[model samples]
Target: MTTPHTVAPSERPHPWDRDAPHAHVDLDALRHNLALLRARTAPGVRLLAAVKADAYGHGLLPVARALAAAGAEAFGVATAAEALALRGAGVPGDVLAFGPVRAGIAELVAADVALTVAQPADLEAIAAAAAGARARVHVKVDTGMGRLGLAPAEARALIAAVDRSPLADLEGVWTHLASADEPDATEPDSATHRQVAAFAALLARLERDGLRPRWAHAANSAGTLLLPEVHHDLVRPGIALYGQPASAWLARRVPDLRPVMRVDAPVTFVKRVTAGTPISYGGTWCAPRDTVVATVRLGYADGYPRSLSSQAEAGHRGRRVPVVGRVCMDQLMLDLGPDGDAELGERVDLIGGGAPTAFELAADAGSFAYELLTRIGPRVVRRYPGT
Candidate 1:
């Protein structure tokens, strides 16, 4: 006869289970980044934190709330829906939808969310949607970025049109920087410098014509960190606020910024493989000698780049281990030498958390940090350990 054994309450599986992967968001690091950015700008220059694309995949509402509490003067989003979501979540201060707003003009106007007027049609739609209510509008000018916004020559006519609309309140005028993150931004012939000059000339013309809006801004993360002259009235810092440098130049310039999110996944299986044994698909990697391999519960589908297959490394037991073989859709294998002792359900640091930072991982994948941060899929659980 054998006695039955019951699992203790503490040993039982958590609600998230043992194999769940998490993106641990450090709210303290986020707040610290915001303060560092604030310190870089001059007094009276408002900080507009870009919380678009679900706060760059760091959980929008929570990141926005943390930023709002950290003294961010305004929030810049890509769409009216994102702006409305922030308003619904009780995020105070200004919310500007800088992207194109083909629909939801009425809802945005009613919600008091500022809409960007990039063209004459956008101005017309916003004015019509205002009805009897006042609509706050920002005229976007194409300084150098030829994607959106009106040409500098065409901006005067649009500004005049906005001035004529009874329901439209011309609150701001802004432009996007094209090469502000490039190393040649300081050169006189560089695109960034030309754009800055062009925008300044436009703002001066508007001021002289008495058509200048209340706010005249043209600065992204790189611009905010590198070009103080371009920080006219506001600065929009996106990736930097999330604690990732916008580029190598910014990283070298601002070395104090800390990464706010760390990706972690649990090891689901551990096994010893014989020499010359192939791992994962296509036999891309084979063991040179007998070694231990650990399978982690994270993959390309969870926003880990497939290009990082056999190129990246993860942290295990305070040791750096090479990611072996091609990464599958739901799992990746790490080579832990013959003496390795990683067990089932052991945590592995995929990115950050004292391991390889997002910048390093992104470089290994031949991509940038912005793409990696935003590409994080919805399946990964976001955990705020110290909110």
Candidate 2:
């Protein structure tokens, strides 16, 4: 006779259950950002939403679907797997793979994803892998980034090679800008100008060699905002799509841009500690006085950086609570001061509070919001309200 085992209800998910420490995505903000991009971009300039890095850790599948529904013409990802994931998520727009495309032709071809031909070898690989699949290809010209793509002179030769390959279809020609974010980040007083000029010269050479791509794009979010002239047939809007201004230039140019993501968590336990009592691991923080500490259910494992140990804060009841002690692997302690009204299970605003922006945390961590968002771990259940 086998005894039946009883499983605890806590171990099972309820029919309508949700976990704590979630990232709430504002769909209205997403739509508004898309509209802003549409209005700012030149007429007929396509907007390609960069949904790479899991849409900057905002849930790629939902964010991609939302952006597509909000009038995005295309989507860009870093890998073939990401593009394929979007296809699986029911994103019915053009997907461009910006990462390496060596032996993963089957995934791209199966998902009808476009490959970015950066090197001559990449073009050759796509040509060989595409076979009769009708592969749409974009040639990436390395103007100033020095990352990938063929050089200005080699672009013509690459275009010639692409023209000879029956497996790949050259649908577009594009390049990336190195320092469009900082107007002075480029040298010679015209580094941005030179890159675009080289891209244009490459295109002219390609045409001279009897190769004409259907589309030509070379603008990222920074390039799109800083130099509208770089907006060719399409513009890739990555951070901008999620409401984070792509650059400082864009912040000055478009102050109305709204960020779509907000990180929020619940106060798990709140207690008072005596003065001089150290908190958290390594005893890094001591209660300056009789202090009220709120233990929030978020930690470095949730993408909240441990470097924010002594610097970060969250909004609670119209006041700011400083994150105290070391940000542990699974939890963080916040000092609520001596006199505060926040209680157990109270909602605390983390990233998108009216007080601390994700930008602030990113700056505190010596990084960018792009990295912050992309690094958010999968533990945080992403909640999309506008979806």
| Candidate with best lDDT | 1
Clashing pairs in 2: none
TM-score of each: 0.95, 0.92
Question: What local lDDT does model 1 show for residue 138?
Answer: 91
Runs in model 2 deviating more than 4 A are 1-19, 185-188
- Which 10 successive residues of model 1 have the least lDDT summed? 1-10
Residue by residue across 240-358, what tens digits does model 2's lDDT show? 77777655555776787788888878788888889998999999999999988888888998889999987888888877889999998878888988886566777788888544777
- State how far residue 157 of model 2 sits from its true place (Å): 0.4
**What is the clash tally of candidate 2?**
0
How well does candidate 1 score on lDDT at residue 207? 88
What's the lDDT of the predicted structure labeled candidate 2?
0.78
Q: CA lDDT, every prediction?
A: 0.87, 0.78
